[model samples]
Target chain A: MKTVKEGEIRRREILDVARELFVTKGYDHTSVNDILKIVDIAKGTFYYYFASKEEVLEAIILDIVEEGARRAEIIVKDQSIPLLNRIMMAIMAQTPEFEGSEEIKEELHKVENAKLERLYLKAMLKRMTPVLQEPVLECIKEGIAHMEYPTECIETILLLGHMMFDCDTFEWKMEEYPQKIQAFLCHAERMLGTKEGELSGFLQMFGQMP
Target chain B: MKTVKEGEIRRREILDVARELFVTKGYDHTSVNDILKIVDIAKGTFYYYFASKEEVLEAIILDIVEEGARRAEIIVKDQSIPLLNRIMMAIMAQTPEFEGSEEIKEELHKVENAKLERLYLKAMLKRMTPVLQEPVLECIKEGIAHMEYPTECIETILLLGHMMFDCDTFEWKMEEYPQKIQAFLCHAERMLGTKEGELSGFLQMFGQMP
Candidate 1:
């Protein structure tokens, strides 16, 4: 039998290979056999790590969520940054970029992979809600922001933010995209108790307007 | 050869039967054959009316959306009601209740029917966005609310409101449901530029908090 460390390494290798294939060739196009071909692992070995392709997709999403949580935790704990900037940074950290992320995102937008898209968003919100709550509550306590139901508000904001701003969640027209981002910033400023135009700078982070 | 009127009537009949079966027996359990048996129509007749069960679902959703738009149009045109109340009424009109709506909602919440839930929400937003825009813009013009991107804000609010409040969109625990509604109200007041607690009275419309 393989040692525990060796088994762990094998699982990591399989996940990496699967993610690469999913991004490069698309999730629907990629298969367990393709993963096994790249990882040079037997079908039994692959099944030992993941029960099915869907499970592997879930595993990939979990890894992204954990990485985001870790980054957000660090940002929350840092005191040198301003409260608003730290909060924004922490929020952006939740969308950590990996190689070929854009291609993977394109794949997720297809109709056949919508369930996976939903799964990814749901998983991100579930995992990041708690991690981002710390900085948000701190902002409230510092009088930088005020909310009656801070915890619930945080969760609502995250859910709305994801649903509105995430391209995978909606099929926005090319011109409509920039307007949606702008509107999100405007509402976010109000929701966070920030002054008008305070959050406008973050629009650049969303990319250039058409 | 059937007359145009007869064809339209037969189409409506098929849709009505399909919707009933979908709600009562659950969408997954219902089939085209089941619908045909209830409607007492031949297979060819059913096909002539609806290409597939999924098309019938689209027709049902379209019917609901059109009904909502019609109601909202009337509410928006009613100057007798106060502006705020009219706006609220118009927004509420988008969720027009039909017989067995609660049951249909329950059916949509099932994991197997998530795609239907998403499709329904998307259809509602697409149709209701324009209908609701008139009242929202009126609020901005009357100085009752302020928004930088009024049209975009309305769409974002509707999209967020649906995703956050609609039980089909997320699986909130019993306790979490009320908190989310409360949070939404707080955020809505801020986003709408209403005074704090101004929108609190509308929470009753969401049903009693458990």
Candidate 2:
């Protein structure tokens, strides 16, 4: 039997090969056999790591979620940055980016892979909520002492941000995009009890103002 | 060829039969042949109305969307009700109820039908936004003369309400439900420029309070 470390290495190899294939070729077009061929692994070995191609995709999604959570946690803990900016950065960090892989991002946007896209968003939100919640509560405590906000507002804000901004969830016209962003900032300020334009700096971060 | 009225009647007949089947037998379990056999129509007749079973579902969804928009329009146009209450009613009207058909709602909740659920939510939001937008804009104009909220906020608020409250989108636990509703109400108050307890009457409408 292979050692535990060796088995772990084999699994990582399979995932890396499958992720590349999924990005280069669409998820619907990528096959387990193709992954096995690229990784030089037997069918048994592929099955040993993942039951099917869908599971491989799920694994990749989980990797992205974990990475995002890691980034958000670090941002949340950083005290040098202003609290509101850190909170903004922490929330923004939850959005999963494929790093240098724009092709994978484009592939996920295709109609056929919509279900996969939904699954990824749901998974990322589920994992990142708790990581970002503490900082959100801290901001509320520090920024809005007079207001009695419920703890559940953190999740509500996160869900609103995700649904409003995610292209897959709510498709706004190109012309309407800036207006929507401005409204989001206004609502965000109201919800977080920040003064108007306190979060305007965030607009500069995006290099656009509405 | 059938007259235009007869064709429309025939199409409704098929949809009614398929909708009953989808609710009772579940969308995945109900086949095109099942619908054909129950409607007492030939395959060609069924296909004449809908391209496939999926198309039939889409038609059912559209019917629900149109019905919701109609109800919301009536609520928005009622001059007797207060503006905020009308706005709340208009937004709530967008949620599609099967009208004594809880089975269909439960069916849509099943894991296998998540894609259908997503499609339904997307269609409902897209159709309802324009219908509800006018009333929302009116409410913002009448209620918040001091504040300059963006017009795009109508869609953002609707999207936030749907995502936060929809069981499919965010699964709040039984105990967490009350807290979530309170948070939503607070945020809604802030966004609409209403006083804290001005919208508390909304909780009474639901027969519960946080």
Give the residue spans of candidate 1 off by over 4 A.
A1-8, A77-80, A96-98, A168-170, A208-210, B1-6, B78-80, B96-98, B101-103, B168-170
- A1-210 in candidate 1: lDDT tens per residue? 789999999999998888888888878799899999999989998999889997887788778778877888799788998878777777776665655665566755555555666777777778877877777888888888877776766666677666666644456877777777777778777888876787788888777422
Docking quality class, candidate 1:
medium
C-alpha positional error of residue B157 in candidate 1 after TM-score superposition, expressed in Å: 2.5
Tens-digit per-residue lDDT, B3-99, candidate 1: 9999999899998888788778877688899998998989998887778887787688778778877898899899998776776667777764656
Candidate 2 C-alpha lDDT tens digits along A148-167: 56355556567766666654
Q: List, residue by residue over B49-137, the lDDT tens digit for candidate 2.
A: 88998888878877887888789889989989887788788877767777865666666556555666667777877777777667667
Worst 10 residues of 2 chain A by lDDT: A144-153
**Candidate 1 residue-wise lDDT at B128:** 77
